[model samples]
Target: MAHVLVVEDDRPTAEAIASELRAHGYSVDTAGTGADALALAQAATPDALTLDRLLPDTDGLALLAKLREVGIHAPVLMVSALGDVDQRIAGLRAGGDDYLIKPFAPSELAVRIEVLLRRTRPEAETVLQIGRVRIDRIRREAQVAGEPVRLLQMEFKLLEFLMRHAGATVSRRMLFEQVWNYHFDPGANLINVHIARLRRKLDMPGEPSAIVTVKGEGYRFDAV
Candidate 1:
C-alpha cells in the first residue's frame, strides 16, 4: 500500500481527505503544521505528499523548497484554495508534481495521486539511452553524446517520458495525461511547443532528430 503524508491545517478537511484515502486502501498520515509535516516526512518517508498552501507555521511552498533542497524526491500534490494560474505555476515551480484547486472531488484527488505515484516509481533501468541522447533518471539529467544538456523541469520530464517509451508510438492524449497529469485534451500545439524546445536542445547541428512526429497521431522517440 502506498503511504501519503497529508499536510493540511484545517482539522476537518485533513480528516476528510485522510478518510477518503484510507477508504481507497492507502495508508494515510496527517500533519497540521509545516514543522510537523517536515519531521514526519523525514522520519516516515511517505511515498507521496498532499500539501496545503496555507499553514500556521510556514507556507507550503517554502516547505516544498526545503524538501527538494534536502533531496526528498517524493511526488507532491499541492492543494490550494487559490485557483489562479500564477499560483498553480508557482506550485509547480516549487517542486510540486501536481496541483489541485479547492472544491475538487475526492475521486479527482485519488486519480491525481495515483498518476503522481506511478510517475515517480523507479524504473528498472536507471539510465535510458536512445539514439544519441542519454537520460540519467537518477540524477534527472540528460546528455547528447557525452555533452551535458541542460533541460528545464518540464522539458526533462517530457524527454524522459518519451525515452521510457522509446521506439513506440505515443499519442498526444497519452503524453498530455502522463506528462502534464491532465486527463483532458489540453492542445496539440501546447505539447508541440515543448517538443520543439526539447528538440532544439537535444539535437545537434546536422543530426537526426531524436523525436519524430507521427502525423495525425503523436510522437516516437527513435531507438538507435
Candidate 2:
C-alpha cells in the first residue's frame, strides 16, 4: 500500500483526511507541525504528501523548500484555504506538484492524491519504447529507429519523463518541477526552448511526430 504524510495543524481536519485516505486503502501518517513533517519525511519518505499551507511551527512553503533543498522529490499536494489565483501560484511556485483550495470534498482530495501517486510511481521496465524511439534508461542512451540519438542531459531527462507518462498530458509546470527540480517558473519560454531542441533531435524524416501538444492543456508523448 502507498504511504502518505498529512500535514495539517487542525487535529480534526487532519484525522478526517487520514481516515478518508485510509478508507481508500492507503497507509497514512499525520503531522501537525512542520518539524514533525520534516522528521517523518526524512525517516520514511512517503509516496506522497498532503501539506497544509499554514502549519503551527512554520510556513508550509518554508518546509517544502527545505525538503527540496535536501533532495526529497516526492509529489506534494498543497492545501490551503486561500483559493485566489495568486495563492495557487504561490503554492505551485513553492514546489508543490498540485494545489487544492479548502472547502473541497474528501473525494476530490482523494482523486487528486491518486493522480499524484500515479505520476510519481516508478515504472518496472528499464527500456521504454514509443513509436520508433527507444530509450535505454539503464544505459542513459536513446535511439531512433536504427540510429543513435545524442541527447543532452536535460534532453534525456525530459524524454524519460514524457516516455514514462506516454499518453498522459504533462503540463509545463509539471515538467519544471520533475525535471528542473525548481518550484518557481523560470519566467520565460525556457521549457519551450528545450522542447523544441528535443523535438528536433527526435523527429525523423517522413515519420509522424512522437510528441503532441494537447491544446490549452500540456504536452503528451504518443503511446505508439
Candidate 3:
C-alpha cells in the first residue's frame, strides 16, 4: 500500500477523503493547514500528495513552491474548485501532476489517485540492457558502458519501461498507455517525439542505437 498525504483545510471534507482512501487500503495522513502538511511531508515523504488549493495559512502555490524547493519529488494532485484553463495550467506549471475540481466523485478521485501512485512506482523488473546501455530498475538509473548517464524525466521513464522487456516488440499503443499515461490518441506522435529525443541523447558520440522501429508494428529495445 502506498502512503498519501492529503492537505485540506476543511475538517469534514479532509476526513471524508481520508476515509475513502483508507477504505481502498491506502495509508493516508491528513493536514488541515499548509504548514502542517509541509511538516508531515518532510517527516514521512509520502509516495504522493493530494493538495487543496485553499489553505487557511498560506497560498497553496507558495506552499507547493516550498515543497519543490525542499526536493519533494512525489507527484502532486491539486484539488481546487477553480476549473478555468488558466488555473489548471498554472497548477501544472507549479509542479502539479494532476488536478481535480471540487464536487468530484469519490470513484474518480480513487482512480486518479491509483494512477498517480502507479506512475510513481511501476512494476519492478530485473536489470535491463539495451546494447551497451544498462539500466537498474530498482535505482531507475542508466549507464552507458561503465559511466553513468542522466536522463530527463520522460526519457528515463520511457527507456526504463522499454528495457523491462527488451527484445519484445511493444506497440506504440501500449507504450503510450503505459509510459505517457495517454491511451486515447487516434495516432500519437508523442512516441516518435520522445524516441527521437532519446536517440539523439543516448546514441550520440559513437554509441550504437538500441531502439528499433518496426514498421506497421511499433518498437523494441534489444539487449546486446
lDDT of 2 by residue, 16-53 (tens): 89998897789999999999999999999899999999
TM-score of 2: 0.56
Displacement of the residue 49 alpha carbon in candidate 2, Å: 6.8
User: What clash count does candidate 1 reach?
Assistant: 0
lDDT of 1 by residue, 185-218 (tens): 7655789899999989888788778899988767
Error of 2 at 184 (Å): 1.2
Ranking by TM-score: 1, 3, 2
- How high is the lDDT of residue 140 in model 1? 90
Worst 10 residues of 2 by lDDT: 103-112
